[model samples]
Target: MAPLRLSLACWDYDRVKAIEDGRVRPEGIELTFLNLRVEETFFRQLRYKEFDISELSLSSYVLTLNDPEPPFIALPVFPSRMFRHQSIYVNLKAGIHSPSDLAGRRVGTPEFQMTAPVWQRGILEDEYGLNYDSPQYFTGNVEPSTTERTEKVPLQLAETVKIQPIPKGKCLAQMLADGEIDALESATAPSTFGTHPDVGRLFPNAKEVEQDYFKRTGIFPIMHVIAVKRSVLRENPWVARSLTKAFASSLEYAYEAIHARGALRYILPWMQFHVEETQAALCSEGNDKWWQDGLTPQNIRTLDKFLEYSFKQGLAKKKWEVKELFAPGSLDAFVL
Candidate 1:
């Protein structure tokens, strides 16, 4: 039997680099890897099913569950995860000194339904006492460029929460910098803040805040999940396990390379110390696993919380179960 050839689209992260460089390959499959920006990948994959397998936004993926026939079925492999406390950017002139000040203020975001903003909003509401429904929202591109980006899925916002796009020529960063919006939450750093001194992060000690949040919540928020097209899964069911095994191997390979004490592979001078610190913060006491994959207890707990947040924020019509999110075969490890 000939091996199946499939297209996979995702960012070129260190964990997936082995698979991209052909050091690791999915069993019985030939992958054509497309290293693309996540937004483009998500847009194409979600809108047109552009690739056989691709990185998907968890929030967007949850929204698809409400569809009668979702175009994609996910694996438990999470390719991207980030602490979103650092994602909040606020204008110094907005009088928003604390999270509580965000209540009744205008806020801007690239997209309300995007995973980072959803996580930030949920965190603000749960941890900091900001009312989720109080702020008026403006959604637009984060960059200063004139190009506009729309939400991939329809939102189900509360009647009291108003959201609109910025004007055709403007962007969220500019809106935030000019004090047109009090704050902005985005996955990508807004360009204006680098040039404009007035724009600053909401949490100055973001690392400490994020570490504290993780210690309290036990959730290092997941941003993206890998998904295979439903038609491909229906035809080649074994591909799910194959891809899972390949990605896990790739992640292990990345860990070994990162932990090698000889020299720094990354640009940062204290990279090893940072890596060790991260491990201490995120990993369980006995295990060396920092960036874990699959639907383990911790991962499932995080996913369930994210789903609840999505539902509460009106991104998902209903709270989805973890079992329904992944292909059945992927829920267990395969043996040779």
Candidate 2:
């Protein structure tokens, strides 16, 4: 039989670059990797079901699970994981000195259902005492000068959760900088973040704060996961296992690239020092430090926490179990 041909739409990140560049190939699959920007990829994939496989926002994926006939089946392989404490940007003019100061503040986000904002909202609620509904929300592109944006997945939030959009031709970065919004939560910094003296991070020392959060919670929040369309998955179940194993191999290759030390794998001059420190901090009892993708206990706990956030925040249509989100046996390893 001919190799299975599939087009995968995802960002070109180091962890999955091997597959993108053909250094790692999924068995029996003729892969066509489309290295699209995350925003474009997500918008196209979610809005139109435009690709055979895609890297989907975790929060958006959860909401889609509520669909009567969900169109996609996810693999436990996370293409992107981020700790979101650093995502909170505040206008200094708002006098927001701490997380508690955010209560009743006007906040802007690209979307209420974006995974980064979901993680940040959860952090504010769980780590601090701020409720998810504490802030009045505005949604718009961080720097969209003309085009309007919409939620990737349809949302039916609780009535108490109030959210609206920025004015047409307006942007979140400008809104925050102008003090129209007290704070902004997004995966990418608003355009005015470092350039505008009036805008600063709510947690200036977000690195230390996030590390402490990990030490306490063991959750490096997951942002994006790989998913295949339900039609494709039902026809070829082996595709799930094939893609999972390929991603695992690619991730290990990335780890080795960083560990090689013969040449700097990343741009940072102190990359090795930080890598070693991260490993020491997160890898007690021999865990992988770079947040490996799989359905291991650590990942399960993390995913479960996100599910709770989704359900409580009214992002999910119903309370969802973690196992319900992924393809059967996709996270398993076959010993050779």
Candidate 3:
């Protein structure tokens, strides 16, 4: 087969290799992975057909559904490491004691429509039974300073939370430290950010979320999914199936290897983030409550539920059924 050219916007050098090793077609299929963030630049490339595949949030994808262009294959749901666990953090000295107290508080977030606020609010409502009272969003200004640039996405949940545009260049951490915002919807691992002395926790919602998910459903909600252009899949269906298998197999391999004592030394080299720290966070903060290795029917259903709620919240314009979104043969009966 000819070499498959692909573009993975997210920079997960280690994780991609793990997928390539496990899932690429014909064993030794050449895949060119480009390191780029999926921003307007990516959309521009898609219009020019400069790439084959890219990662996209479901909400963002929905906004472009009206275009005459082909749609991307929503790869098997990979529960976001962040949303799989909800970590409700607040300023320690704010005197806020519980989720209930967060009701009128000024909360900061990068995006409202994105997963950050959706899942964060879910935690507050579903678990703590508290209303965060629509978060205050920070839409980094146009030509925002470096700081503002980092937080530019518009708020999807502003109706649920207040929206505030912090000037560019100001560290969100500093805002948290100075009590400008009581909390931040850190959609990634908490360790992704430096340990903040001011940002203490009332309830480590990340751990609580996993527990709550397991109690309600058999799996944790799926987060980010590797998206493929639907036209590309129509031309080559096997590629989609192969990619799904590869992703699941890679994750399974990682899980098994980590359990086989002494493998950490070998696995450490492939990790982009600190291996020990990520591993520790995985162990302490990891949500295996419903993880049976990789994606499962329950996982897909969770994603559907999330999308449904997102659409109602206006984060997404339409509801994409699981069968319609995922590639055929992508979801196997048994989790690896």
Q: Which ranges of candidate 1 are over 4 A from the true structure?
A: 334-336
lDDT of 2 by residue, 21-51 (tens): 8999999899999999998888888889999
lDDT of each: 0.89, 0.89, 0.55
TM-score of each: 0.97, 0.97, 0.73
For model 3, the stretches where C-alpha displacement exceeds 4 angstroms are 1-4, 13-15, 21-29, 35-50, 62-70, 77-80, 83-86, 139-147, 150-161, 188-197, 204-209, 266-295, 329-336
Residue 325, model 1, lDDT? 91
Candidate 1 lDDT tens digits, 1-336: 999999999999999999999999989999999999998999888888889999999989888888888888899999999999998999998888899998888999888899998898888999988877778899988876656789998777788778899889888888888888999989988887778988999999999999999988899899999999889989989899999999999998899888887887887888788888988998887987878888778898899989888988877878888888999877774344
Please identify which of the two predictions, 2 or 3, would achieve the higher lDDT against the true structure: 2
Specify the poorest-scoring 10-residue window by lDDT in model 1. 327-336
How far in Å is the alpha carbon of 267 misplaced in model 3? 8.4
Report RMSD (Å) for each prediction in the order shown.
1.3, 1.3, 5.8
Error in Å for residue 183 of model 1: 0.1
lDDT, candidate 2, at 284: 70
Candidate closer to the true structure by TM-score (higher is better), 1 or 3: 1
Task: Give the poorly placed runs of model 2, Cα more than 4 Å off.
Answer: 334-336
